[model samples]
Target: MRKFTIALDAMGGDFGPHISLSASSKSLQLHPNLFITIVGDAQQITPLLKKYQLLNHNRIKFVHAPETISMEDDPVSVLRHRSQSSMLVALQLVAKGEADACVSAGNTGALMLLAKHTLKTLEGISRPALVSALPNNRGGHSYLMDLGANLQCGCDTLFNFALMGSVLCEQVEQLSAPSVSLLNVGRESNKGNDTIKQCAEMLSATEFINYIGYIEANELFDGRADVVVTDGFSGNIALKSYEGMGRVFFERLQQAINTTWYSRLLGKVLNPIIKNQLKNLHPDLYNGASLIGLRGIVVKSHGSANESASFYAIEQAIKEIQWQIPACISARLESVLAERDCLSHE
Candidate 1:
């Protein structure tokens, strides 16, 4: 296997180096060819590295960043002031070609700002988007994009998102002509505002896109479409609502299971079956969201991720490196633009 290096923002998340370092250790164990550069305050990271017995590991490198970006820190303020922050350093490593990818569990706004500033977007991409997979009724996954990157997007931006998302699903999911759908208020042609209608028209006209009709929010996880496109506002709300509902469902089930001695006995007997069936709905399984359309790979983890989830984020970065996702998206966009040019001239 070809070796790849990842720069991790160790001090970005709620648990800081404690969680990041632990996840890095687990990742290194799983991927022997993987090397990690832990970026953060050396004073804090050094002790934890020693605790994890990875202080002198050959596969590990430490880059000290004097400052850190807090979850509450404004993106613009951090871009102006926190030059030596861990998050910035990690992204810079990718920009400078010192790392194959960068992974962070930091301020969403700050990370997006720094990633865009450091790495820039692809030639045709106006803004980077956050895309992740959601479990579907077909026992597979569907890709969703703009999960809180840009709250308001124009028709052009939405069109670009569909293209980007289509390429992602085609490459990562290895599906030919993956079906693409817009998340909207209704499926009928007459429904939705002007922006949605216009974006729908664009998608439908593009021969390169396998554009299906609109998908309502209720059908998000129905597995009818391979990729679902939406503005960040609606996508973010849908994602959070799904995650929240999963948590509530499991919590309520556990409560009922523990209500009485007979219930506890029944729960014990059904534990394995329940776990097997519900594994797909666990939030930890979908912890990493790729900030696509950037020049380099950037995977964002949930700020509240535990070691398991953080490791999943690292795995996500590794997969992107192997897949060469940026290159794929760029190539696909170029072809689509060429097709558009031909159509315009005719």
Candidate 2:
């Protein structure tokens, strides 16, 4: 396999250097062809390096970025003032072609702002969408886009999302023609507002899209479609609600299992099975959210990610690198747009 160099924001997450640097060690071990440059304060990174015993590995290196953009930092303000911050520096590595991709567990708003300023969106893409995969009924994954990115998207913006989302599902998941759905309240054609209705029309007319019509929120994980496209507003609400439900469901399940001695004993017997199910739904397993439509690859790990979660993000970036995902999206996008433009004029 071809080697990939990753630029990691080493000090920005809730767990700081310990989790991020340790994740680097895990990634390097898993992929021998991978190289990582951890961007953060030398003072903070060195101890973690020593603790993890990762300094001697030539594939792992560091760049001193003394500043950090905290979770509470204003995205616009950080972009203007924190030029030397680890988040910005790490993104810069990807823009400068020094790194194949950048992975961060940092301020989401700040990362999005910095990425747009540094790399810009791809040609024909209106905006970058925050996308992640979720386990579906088919024992495979479904891609959801505009997770919290474009809050108030237009019909065209929603159309762009479907285009980007379908390409993403195809490139990353190796789906030849991924089935896509527009998330809405009802499955009827007339259910959604003007934007979604019109967007659906566009999707239907597009010969390239494997458009599967409307899907309700309840069917999100039913394997009804391989990809779900929505504006950031509703998509964000649904995503958070889904995540909250998963946590609450497992907590309640555990409580019920421990209600009595016999039940507790049964719980222990079923512990491994429960753990496996939890692993499938765990936020850590799906920690990385790809910022698609950008000129370079950027994977956003959840801010609260631990070592394993952070490693998942790194591995995601490595896969994108191996697949040349961005290039594939760009090529597919150019074809789709060009074909549309031709029909528009004709």
Candidate 3:
């Protein structure tokens, strides 16, 4: 009765209904009062829902939307023709106030375009950046922003990115005076290019942010800062590299254990411990990234997401709605910008 419902796109990701159904089963089981309106072709989703025995639940409803948005299709064109497409329908539900949030594992570009076009950005927000929560060696996690949204950015954009990332920490991470840092090659005050130098100055001069100096790549895993801000291009490459390194290490560890009898025995003993230690590094756990600064909370999961990943995304959407993160962020930004404007006048 809390009026918390999420609009999910059943046809978004690579695995489509399979992942969606599995995630839905888990989500519905965990939250009895929660409702989800899955948007997709009835012909495709009905069978899966029935097979999973989720068809009869009053809380679980299906909205008949038959079109699909392809990864290769033009984002604008797909949103136009595929008016009934699962992604568009899900977003529309959020825009129309029927759902609290929208979750999609579909084309990232298309989702951003539709979210911007449909719900529009918060007042004064230049662009919405894809932000993720990543594990830190110290403990818990940190927020990394502009992971895959903008490529070419100005110093002002980076400054705004820092503010947005901090707002997320305050709202989602519940951190007071969250430490903010810039991604750069060195910690020196005069390091790298003009962009880095200018951003360093801006961050140092910021009143709201707990401005830490430049953090190197190695410091990212060491928990050097709470919110790390960078352009989308650099942030994307860093995220991909982190994932790639984790996979390579996991596979190598498995292969080393299979080579001989003694090694196999040792591996069996250590595998469980190793897995427990590395659980945070799994893609399934961190697959969902929130497109911050939007009017509604939009969670973008990996395109190749499986059931586990899908479920995490849906769960995140639920929490975002509960926390009213989008609304809180908008208010925070407006306040911060207003304060800055008043100071400039003084």
TM-score leaderboard ranking: 1, 2, 3
Best-matching candidate per TM-score:
1
TM-score of 3: 0.95
**Which ranges of candidate 3 are over 4 A from the true structure?**
1-3
Residue 305 error for model 3, in Å?
1.0
- TM-score per prediction, in order, is 0.98, 0.96, 0.95
Of the candidates shown, which would achieve the greatest lDDT relative to the real structure? Answer: 1
lDDT of 1 by residue, 1-346 (tens): 7999999999878876799989999999999999999999989988999999989999999999999899899999999999999999999999999999999999999999999999999988999999998999999889998899899999999999999888888888789999999998889999998999999999999887899989998898899999999999999999999889988999999999999999999999998999999988888888899999999999999999999889889988888898899999999889988988898999
- lDDT values of the candidates? 0.92, 0.88, 0.85
Off by over 4 Å in 1: none
Better of 1 and 2 by lDDT: 1
Q: Which pairs of residues clash in candidate 3, taking residues 3 or more apart in a chain or in different chains?
A: none
Mind giving the per-residue lDDT tens digits that candidate 3 earns over 1-346? 5768889988888876778888988998999778999889999998998888889988888899888887788887986787888899899999999988899988888999999988898877878889888889877678887888787677878888888888877777788988999898888877878987898788787687788888888878787799999888999998888878877988898899999999999989998998899888776787788887789989998888889989999887887887888787777777878877987999
Model 2 scores a C-alpha lDDT of 0.88
Give me the runs in candidate 2 sitting further than 4 Å from their true place: none
Query: What's each prediction's clash count?
Result: 0, 0, 0
